[model samples]
Target: MKSIKSAGVIGAGVIGSGWIARLILNGIDVCVFDPSKDAPKSVEKVINNAERAYKNLLRSPLPKKGVLSFLDTVSEVAKSSEIIIEAVPERLSAKQSVYKEIELNASNELIITSSTSGILPSDLQSEMKNPERLTVAHPFNPVYLLPLVEVVGGSKTSQKVIDETCSIFSNIGMFPLYIKKEIPAFIADRLLESVWREALWLVNDDIATTEEIDDAIRYGFGLRWAQMGLFETYRLAGGEAGMRHFISQFGPCLEWPWTHLMDVPEFTEELVDKVSNQSDDQSGKHSIDELMQKRDDNLVDFLKVLKENRWGAGNTLKEFDDSLGNSRIDFSELDVSKPLKTFSTHIPKDWADYNGHMTEARYLDCFSEATTELMAIIGADEEYIANIGSYFTVETHIRHLDEVLIGEGIYSKTQVIYGENKKLHLFHWLHHNDGRLLATAEHMLIHVDLKTRGASMPGDSVIEKMERIYSAHKNLPKPEGLSRAVGDKV
Candidate 1:
């Protein structure tokens, strides 16, 4: 399969713009064609939001964003693209015309995909000349953060096309699940539709308000679903007996009239008004933009937790980070005798406290990031942490020297004070952009075998590098706060 380096998007609606953001963030040049007068503005808004989310979502350094181009015609976009994704409105005739245009303008080798939520792939490919290149690559909203994408092939679609499409999506940090058979709505949407239908019925019957329904999911099973799907979650409910036991225990509920899955309530004006009014009441204080920002922030925190645990969506993020390759700065040319400038970043609004300045604990976070950078420079990167060994902070001493307000840029310079086979002593000085020292940290770390959870010496090469850095800093004048105890001299 050819590597995908450039892509074309046929629409600049929500899904299309999201695809554009994901592709560009993954370093794929994109050309977009959408005739809507407001396409440029809307797509630009989505891109901005996506960039903000990415800063918090990704821990590893990101590649330079690919160039984005707006084109006047579908033929123009298709000519320059290796993959053409159609995210036009969900109409059979409209989508068929898009496929026809793409087929005429693009090469036979070009991969063509549709982001239709439920339309069958075979129906979509019916009007195309080379239908074998067409398939459904359905993705969820906020595509840049969510990893799931259902790749379903039509009857005429080739296995090679499916495999290559999966590879391309995976390259862009997505988890592509191949559907063995083409079905309307594929997998995720079908499940979502079922819940949505039930939710509507509950509201229609006045059994639950819209906010209550949302609370039911967001406060309960929704958390479990992030890491474990329905069946797996139920398996645990069986209390050690597992899936079969759980089914036997709750099997009778299937026959019970507990759910109205087969029937759906009509979308009457009264029901719509009731649901809308309740929804407005529940979230009237926040605009759509605010809600979107909040959602993205929560997702970032959730995914970070998952990444640390190496489970679910976090695993996908970890794999993506590994694929991004090393982006650490080359410290070889620096004068090791002085403090090595390792990390710098702007303080985000979320890091501020009630006083509108950076919170106390966030200082530690800044220092920790600097320590990670220092480790990466000394060869304790992702591979070393996974396979060989890693340094764990055993003790930390933080002294706050000055206050840093929100939006201020801060940097840290680290020096290796001591190093041995299994022990490392380090200090970091945090400073504001104005050259004022904000804080300082002293940390003691121990190298440990990840598998054994015991202290272990790192490889000889890493040790040698640490020794050199230690030697460089041995004679440098120590900072005033070094080795000071928290007590007044009598």
Candidate 2:
């Protein structure tokens, strides 16, 4: 996939700011134009949240941060960018004006995209001189974290543009779902609209409060939906009999009045007040900032869990991780002559102790993460564990060299002290961003067959790579605390 190095964003509201955040984090420079005075703060807020969530959710090192600029006009943003993202207000006239400016200022090579939630791309491209370059790249809110993007093309949109958009998005750690048939609201939003209609009716009729409806989802089917979509999950209900049999038994329910989805309740002022009051009652205590933090934290944790299990959205995250491995320094392909800097991330607030410095357990976590990456570098990944064998840490020594304050960035450099047959020895130095040594850990690992759980020889691939690393690292002075135990001086 050809990477998009520079992008232009036309607005900086919730969706526009999200696009800017996602783009810049992937190391793409962005120029944005939004007339509102709050645009800068909005983008900054989203970027901060995105950085926090990404540092927490992803273990791999991120690419170098990109440059961001705020421009006075759409023409300025369009002329400077390889791709133009129109995230203006959803109104047709507002969007059309932006497109006209883009056509006048941008080169024909530019790829122009819209972030409209439901507006058809055909309508958006109708007044464009380069309609073929224009497509709807609808993304969900908090776009930095969510991977799904719906790439829909209008009648004049070339397949080349659609393919290019998907490739660019995928390269930047997004799943660009090429929506073949353009329709109102696209796919996922349509599904959401059904539930939304039903929920609104439920609230209007006083059958359920806003909080209760949310509870029904988050507590019940929401978990299932995360890993398996609606149909696949329902397919499980069929059991050994299969979906056909399950449908035979329960499909008739669709004919029944189980849903108010077919009709939307009157959107009256009273109904709005009812929902507003109930929603406020449910979560008015938390500021929007607080709610956004909670949302990002919860989503990141859930993604991490899913990543561990390699399911659903988690699978997408893992693939994205694979793509972004060593974004700052490619670990698998690094020079073995030096200590390998395999991991880097900020010390999130949750990792801190009461005194506001990084706590002890997280030290082990950071070391283990670096070790795991080293293991993968030598052919001991999850697939290897499932099929062949893996290295199990048998012993560890950690020295606290200095304090890592909350929000401080830290990184690790690894040394292979010994690698032969069944045993492997590792030394990791955790360094603060400013070059201070924060901590050090030495680990002893034994390769074990998964079936027997006994010490065993790893594959030649693993042994060979480890030997190479060990050979290169043997000449370097031993790590300061190479074999030091607890309470021992360095």
Query: For each candidate, what is the lDDT?
Result: 0.87, 0.90
Over 4 Å off in model 1, which ranges? 1-4, 321-325, 328-341, 344-352, 359-365, 381-460, 463-490
User: What is candidate 2's lDDT per residue for 240-338, written digit by digit as tens?
Assistant: 888998899999988998887768888899999999999999999999999999999999888888999988888889988877774433446669999
Residue pairs with backbone overlap in model 2? none
Alpha carbon lDDT of residue 276, candidate 1? 91
**Where does candidate 1 have its weakest 10-residue lDDT segment?**
322-331
Instruction: Compose the digit string of candidate 1's lDDT tens values, residues 163-278.
Output: 99999998778899999987788999999999999999999988999999999999999999988889989999998899999999999889989788899898889988998999
lDDT of 1: 0.87
RMSD of 1: 4.7
Clashing pairs in 1: none
